[model samples]
Target: MTIKSHSSRESRNPRDFNDPRNKPQERSERPERPERSEWASRRSDRPEGATRERTERSRPDWAVRTEQRRSPRERFEGGDRPRPPRGAGLLAELRELDRDLIKMIARRSRMLTRLPASGASDHERELRTSWEEHASAVSRDPKLIRQIFALLQEVEVAPADMEQPTAFNLAPMRKPVNVDLPAPASDRLPRVHMTLAASGASECVLHGVPLNNPVMECLKGLNQVGARLRWEEDGRILCQGGEPVSGYSKSILDKVVHVGDDPFNLFLILFQMVTRPARLKIIGESGLKFVDLAPLRHFLPLLGARLTSVVPGQEGLPARLESSAMLPSEVAVPADLPADAVEALLIAAAGWERPVTMALGEHPEGRSVASKMLPILRDAGIEATLTDAEGALSLHVVPGKAHFGVEPGTGINLSAAAALLALPALAGGSVKLRGAWDATGDDQTREGVRELFAAVGLDMRFSADCAAVSFGEGLGEDAELPPLKPLTDLSGLPSSLFPVGLVLALIPAVRAKGGDLPRLPQNTDMTLVESFLNQLGLSCEDGRLVSIAPASTPWASPSFPWALALSLAAFLRPNIKLVNPGIVTNHLPWYWNAYNSLPTPSLARKSAEEEAAPAPSRPARRRVLASHTPESEMPDEIVYPDED
Candidate 1:
């Protein structure tokens, strides 16, 4: 059957209606549509039990037994349904409904996946328009999709062709009204800034500690440029930074600057200030997992640094960068730039002698950390302007006095933290995560986690300072956990939070299927989390499904928030301490408070080896060995791709 375009359907040739087969009949003829079913006559033509008795009499007894074992639906509508009698119009409508539903579903799914990556195209708009029009033609209610599915299954006859009141076999549905809350904003203005106003000494402490590599790497890179860094026993970083290095040593030439696991953002400003030509590198040897750094190769060259070979592919890491002395003060933004890279440029530009202008192909708005940084820069006396011409964005930044001794506070990992607090704490009561700056929160990350949790009967809402939480409707004690919804798109959830998400999500699977040991998202440190979970004495196996039996909390992993969550979910302790609590502190400055606010401190489980091991042999031991430092470093043992 051919579906006509909405606009031209009324103008079809008059003769097309004459055949009656090509056009729909008037509503007055609807009664005749149902009277046309000839199946009842076919069934009545045979004497009751005659066919079965005759077949049994002619064939073996086993043949009669086989016919009695078939299901009713199978017996009535054979695996292949024969066409209905009376012109087979209902059959045609059912087949057409199935065809249209399948086509629209495939097209809509594809279009939605593409729309998010690239802005909508003409074809996309047309598809959307056609879909909406087709939907309206089928049903005016919001339950149109469900109705179409029902019609295809013969639960209801075609609503469009129904002229009789009882044409529909489906019962009327009474769905309750659900009011949608306002969508949360996407820009959370969590930023790291330097106020050169602290002193001429050039001392500043970065807040994002990222596991251990980034912190160690940051110290190494800064120390090479003449800075003194120390890890305070209290978990705060103290840096008695000195003057910035003006040159790279001759020994360092013709070699990768091996910045260890330090975040590449350090290079944004550190490379921009060279008085002469220099060579630099950003290596992720200690950590393979990270955000995209390719944008930096495009971004730094504008600031007098030329980058080469961004080593990490889409899923790998540890990028290589080359730096030159001259700086580029004005350049257009690349098609894609990392948030860290953009913020780094903005902060680094402050130390420059002249103003810098970074133009963008499109406005990021609240979608990126860089876009939100503009207002903060403006507030700090860095002249900043967001201009749009023909829908493109150009940010004009004027240099201002840089400061030191600044505290760039925390932006809670909503997904990680929510999976930590609310999901496990459902039995205990409300979980309070105070001290988070919601107004300047990471909008993209929060929204991503929110949308994901909303699917499985979890609800979270934001307020000043913290997020209020609750379980979804229809959930109660003895109620089974909601079924796991398959995730088609991973873009909405940040890669960093994927580990914790997996930890919370796999719990139900364990409960339903005894155990589930799925592969962790290798790109996001699932392997590391697996190690941690095993160390904590969970029934987890390497390269195997996770098992949740005997004290198992369905799903439990050694991941950041999940480990913390499992502690509260199945086990509780009055006073506890974690072996590597720094993982939480890396992203959050006020992690202690966040943990303390929870009703209990059960997350303090440590491996038996860690508890029984002797204390460090030295008074102060650096995480990265001194034997690996520039003065007397060991030869590089780079991990090859094929290595197990």
Candidate 2:
């Protein structure tokens, strides 16, 4: 009714609840409920506490999630990789340190083994003392203590390979005594007894006493200078403490006995005497027969004592009182064995404050005696001054003030014994030598002597026929003294034997480009060469002349250890099939063995064609066109050529 007035309002009645604009629109912002089964829906509708419990059971614990999860970078960095224990790097470093320490100690031990027989110089003594102290400290260090234990463990883990023979079942040899006794001759000279007194026993007795010869005279000169000796009973001698002799007098000392004789054996008896006589003199029938008092002139001054020639109105040669008092300081005797019997005595006595001196040319026999004594004197650390005018070597007593002044072109024995004796002294002083030659009149010996001087770092010069030596002031107190050059061989005159040892000693020097020596005598004994080679871990074949092949570097046995491998090769094989043993010893057993082991060749036949295949015919070639023609284009061509 009244539809005309209520037009719009009439449509908004209760029936219009479904109006299009007013209808509930589908939710665009509010999230829709996920479709779920009835069980899930019912589960969501559970009580709050029950819901929490269910959630707890379904979800993993936060602790577990954190433990399982890791960043990609962390995983890439290997966070799960294992690590070494603490202090492992430090332990490794310690092991290396320990090895270094052990190596140092071993090196020191080797150096000590090579110490020279002569007493150490003040500087050397101090250095050695310091090294000892340092070694002791190293031994006591805590780190070293730990390293010792570790080393012990390492040794237990890995044992060394010892190649020595452990079992011995060989039988011992029993030889008869006095198998070869010389028949007593009625004309033999009566034995004379002599007594000597010195710090060492060398003055007391001379074992294997050589018959009174030129060599013995030389030795007597040395003994008179260095020790107080007196004749006792028949064929007996007494000795007391005296000054040590000098090495400069070795040449004279060596002249006292034959070459190739062991000076040590002869001097042993003297070395063993203990009596120290205040006043000693010889009283015997033949005491003066073999005695040559000329050496005393040089010997007394070396012992801080002077020799007074008691001239009874100067009738003939004056009687001498060669005596001196020993100072409080102790002298050092060298341990080196002399090359010959006479040299052994002189070397033994060279350490005295006042060394015995000998004038070379004064007495007729002085030069002979000095040549023999040179080796021993030089070895004993005594100053030998060869007075240019007298041709004598004065054993000066002024240890600190002694000087070895030598003239140019001085003719001195340069034998192996002499070279060895002179090396120590020349290494310490300035000397001028002239007219040096081998027994064979060759320059090789002199060259060798120069080389030896260079090898030992001594300042020396040599020419085709001459040599000059200059002692540096640093060579002890009496650095200016000339050195004694002993004769290694005395079969003939000094001119003959002087070069033997000199040449032998020079071998190493010559090989080092110092110079060359001439061939040695064929009959010269090479026992010294053998001993030297043996010491160097090598063996000699052929005679004294041979060459060595280049590539022979076999590991040497410890029994034949050498300081320098090349030195061994050079000295043992001097030239190639040339070996010299300086003075030989009859006791050397390897001589025959080595001599018989030389190489020989087998004779065989050779074919004539094989021997003469030098000439051959050449093949002719024709020129070919230089064109890049294909196989299809070429009419005919050889792809492979035959080699004729």
Candidate 3:
């Protein structure tokens, strides 16, 4: 019921000035403000000033304990939505109770630090007794309160005195290994699918790791437009679907309207789907600054949405969509939409009242959200037709009522195979990846993953439902690969693979910096890669061809798995632990177990450094392989004849 804008939350002033980070910067120490090109012809058009520092770092905000109170006359409400007012009489009592409980816990915690080891048993018993007494008291004299007393009972009795927490270095986790190897792949993460619910909940139950930022923001977009979403304790994000902001109403969000800096992939299309008489203006910031939003600007207006006010080529956001009544039956989709921007568009288009034909000038890869949407859209009672003329793909959609039933799941991620093969243990061993194909028969992206493996020395094989790859003898030495091959249309591979590709390309060039990376069709978010590597003790600088490198500090931090695996396999180091490693669940939660299963390259006679060379001085090349093509026409390396 309450929408917390991640962007706004991050920008909020820290409540505690006591935090060491909030210390005022010395006048000389403050970093100089960089010159911006914010083209503000009017004062109102100028971007919010606090916006930069708010997004300077991609790290997540500290979880705010404060509950968002809904307004009495709240937007989109038909009944009383009770919200506890903060710092008032009743709520203030709850806060004081919370403080008292915390203090009690802190007191007990401090007592453990002073208690003698010989007397720790007695101290522990005393604390346990106190907790039991409190629980029994609450049971007997239960007061009608805001449930603060539950905290006291939930406290864990501490060790009178135990080991103090110490920071541990996790670099060796990725230290390159030398061993004979084989690897396995599994589809373990919860599969998330779009539900065609005409009424009731449009539930997206998370199957694997908990939702990360990008995924969270995508769902949050749905939440803002009337999808009542809440995380069930079982880890499902249950969304009561079809509650669009039909008309203008106030959101708790401060009135400076803009889609905050977070990137919402295909979810942005939901803005158009929101019940109109409502005006939605999404302003892009930071990572989205360079994205060309021409497709949205050109096409959204064709629908009953107004964007005539948006000044072209000046704003980071696409054209503002003011809901209108006129709808276009036919529209052409541009070839340049980044992967994040296209999903919501397809769903919205498919659900239109009349048959809508979308002309996709050229679809380079069949693994993007767009590719997956073709089948899902069809299953939703929309007649989806694919016609290719001289290899250009055009989709014709005939609108029909949506029906709920079983559809195919997303394809298994094979980027883990790249990391596994990059390991030195597999220099001469074989690797097989099961669960690479989707029930939807989406294999194009899986092939791209295999293609990246092929760029090294791995040979790949595919089946109706599975895939495998093997490495050659002394593979690491003979393979003089480039620093991550340019990340173009990634064909639905995990975005983390881009950085992994960079690491693997350096298999033969440990001393060399990375190569020029192609901004991908998926509009890959390097922020996560940067955050992952930054935690890994490496620094990430964004550019068309970012020369990826780490600070001069001793190489460490195993936060990012692919980044860690790349470093270990490329550099041959000890296995390390991931800082907040659980974040991997967003893209490849299962890869962690698969990573541990991989044999460490601890036995290599020669390290990646011993065989390292100068990065190849070569111009970028576009290598597009024809799908379902004859083996005779394809390169020996890229060809994979599916076994019957």
Predicted model with the maximum TM-score:
3
TM-score of each: 0.45, 0.21, 0.48
Over 1-644, each residue of candidate 3 has an lDDT whose tens digit, in order, gives: 98988776755367878776778889999877544543333533746864444544443444221112544445345435576566578887899999997787878555556668897547645665565567665565333221222233234555558764333233333322333322222222222243233212343433332444444554555455555656554445554555432223322221124343454543343333432444555544443443455555565665655553243223344345566535567666656655545555555554455666666665343235546667666654567877767755666776544454553333344455556555532244454444435542234445566676666545666666655554443445446422333334333445546655655543332333333333443555566545444332344345423333443333333334454454444242233334344445544444445455444432124568756744468556779887696868977576669999
Please give the TM-score that candidate 2 achieves against the real structure. 0.21
lDDT of each: 0.48, 0.35, 0.47
Question: What is the total number of backbone clashes in candidate 1?
Answer: 16
Clashes of each: 16, 119, 24
lDDT of 1 by residue, 416-526 (tens): 465544443233234445544453446666666667666544556667666655543444444444454543334345664554454454445344442545444435555
* lDDT of candidate 2 over 400-464, digit per residue (tens): 21112321111233342232223223223333333323221223334555554454345565554
Better of 1 and 2 by TM-score: 1
Task: Give candidate 2 misplaced runs (Cα > 4 Å).
Answer: 1-349, 353-356, 363-381, 390-587, 599-644
Q: Please report how far candidate 1 places residue 257 from its true position, in Å.
A: 5.2
How many Å off is the CA of 244 in candidate 1?
A: 5.0
lDDT at position 293, candidate 2: 34
